[model samples]
Target: MTADPRRSRSARHAQPSAQRAAPAPRKEPITVGRIADAALEVVATEGYDALTIRRVAAVLGTGPSSLYAHIVNKDDIDDLLIGRLYAAIVLPEPDPAAWREQVTGVYTQIRDLYLEYPGVSRAALAMVPTNLETLRVGEGILAILLAGGVEPRTAGWARDALSLYVSAYALEQSLVRQRRRNQDQEWVLGDEELLDRFTALPAERFPQTRRHAAELISGTGHDRFAFALGLLLDNLRPASG
Candidate 1:
């Protein structure tokens, strides 16, 4: 049977319309969460020092003015970034028997996170623990210390010290990694080279360093980190009943 000319023509037109490329996906709306994600991407790729309000806006394909609706400024972005990072840490139940290990694990987790985004610890160092997530981490640490029978004052001070040490450690590692990336490797010497330099120092001016060069230059990977953390925790004597 011969097809109707009108029907054939209509079918031809409908085929092309059905085959047309799909419309472009709608742009996702900007939100505080999206802003935080874009800001973190900036830090993860370009380092925390490279993160800025304009940069995050650019990353999200928007203008700085748009980001202001969600974030107040770069400081605000820092808080958001820190909160996001802290949110990833799993707080342990305060176990009096394992409080020391729990505390170390928490800080180690934070240190690892900071190292993942080079120089991110700089933001943490500058930030006060005002964000809920940041405060939560502090609370978790304090709970563990208190459960271990550490004095309230000592636990408070210890929390501050641990936070400071972790940030400082991560910052130092990030700086060293940055230097190496920039091909400024002279200051990032190998253990043997560092030991040699320590021993080469004037005997009178650096007697202890020269004598203990190997010890000073020791600690592979995070051995020094563990050792220092131990020193801080070991000194805390649980309050006697």
Candidate 2:
């Protein structure tokens, strides 16, 4: 044993090698899903207008060119963002008796989601509902309308109308919130202040506006949303046979 100095030295080196920990696993490669997640994070933190392909890529620690391999362009990212948000909605089975309630619930879900990521609804305005998830929502609403005996054409048109209303409502709310955040914007006033301003207009020429100032600022916290939704849904009568 004493004569084998080279073998002893090799054994000491091998012992440290065997005891050393293995290298850490590599980070997961970027995918479409990961890209979508990063985009949402950007929108959530910085608002939707701040979301760009380059920003998303920076969030994912990659270059914009790499994202192009997974997504087409900024419009493509908008589609993905809206599609991902729509995917979270839980569609209900059509019930003729409860169609109105079900439709209201779905629209409420969409409104809440849009509010969660301010300005995200702007992406929905120009979208054509081509994404599978977006189409799924449209299909769900159509089923409910048809179940309630609405004519096919009416149901289709009503779906579009309701979608437009929700998107516009969300976008308006987002814009108001943004304005409120900037205190320097005089137009961003409380309902009472707005009513006062309306009432302060010249009397003779602005009689109607002054008289109806309270009514003009009447609704609060989606009361207008509910009223408009009811107006749209309540008028949908089944065609006479």
Candidate 3:
């Protein structure tokens, strides 16, 4: 009679069956990911300014001492969250056929990502994207510039210029959105109120800005954004060799 392999295999595995079923002890019960997740929860509900180590610990059912075992400080948590978030972003491959479109598309994706995460947008200000995905974005942009015959230095600076533009614009929008939200309950001030305050200034004192009021605030906020993006893209065209 042929022996059943299943029975033989079962007998061999039976010796350490208890141990096999035993739950593995977690290496360092708390982890950086856990701390980051806790922090994200706090930010999602409470906003950026309200995100604190103490609050995160409370969510994790741990004390500050335990959290310290994982993260160094509140700033460390913020940095980790930003880097982790950056790593998850998916940027398109460099396309010489559509380099300008690729660059603008990346910026648009990043803007949408920051706004979706709300509180994290403020923390991202002036911070370099040292994470892999972000660095990849820079690398992809450089590759496209190289394909278009841009100098290495110009390509590098273009990366910085684009990142700065996107980050600064996002931060400003976040601030404006927050300000409006905070005032949502009260009687919202109208654009006329803002213009009235501006025009009330002595004519000679603020003539330039006040004189071009229509020009200054002519379009929807995004209208100016598209214009700024186009202006920057126009500067990237390589001069004839």
All models, RMSD in angstroms = 4.1, 4.1, 9.9
Q: What is residue 107's positional error in candidate 2, in angstroms?
A: 0.2
**TM-score result, candidate 3:** 0.72
Candidate 2 least-lDDT 10 residues: 11-20
Score candidate 2 by lDDT.
Answer: 0.90
lDDT of 2 by residue, 142-190 (tens): 9999999999999999999999999999999999999988979987789
Sorted on lDDT, highest at the top, how do the candidates line up? 2, 1, 3
| Number of residue pairs clashing in candidate 2, backbone atoms closer than 3 angstroms, sequence gap of 3 or more or interchain | 0
For model 2 the local lDDT of residue 91 reads: 94
As a whole number from 0 to 100, the lDDT of residue 202 in candidate 3 is 75
For every model shown, what is its TM-score relative to the native structure?
Answer: 0.86, 0.87, 0.72
Q: Candidate 1's residue-wise lDDT over 72-105, tens digit each?
A: 7788888889989999999999999999999999
Model 1 misplaced stretches (Cα beyond 4 Å): 1-26
Per-residue CA lDDT of candidate 3, range 1-241, in tens?
Answer: 9999999998887776446566886655678888877877787787777788888888888788998887767677777667656665566776677778877777787777676666576666666554465566667777777776666787788877877777777777777777778856454445677667666767888888778765665676667777788788779766358
In terms of TM-score, which candidate is strongest? Answer: 2
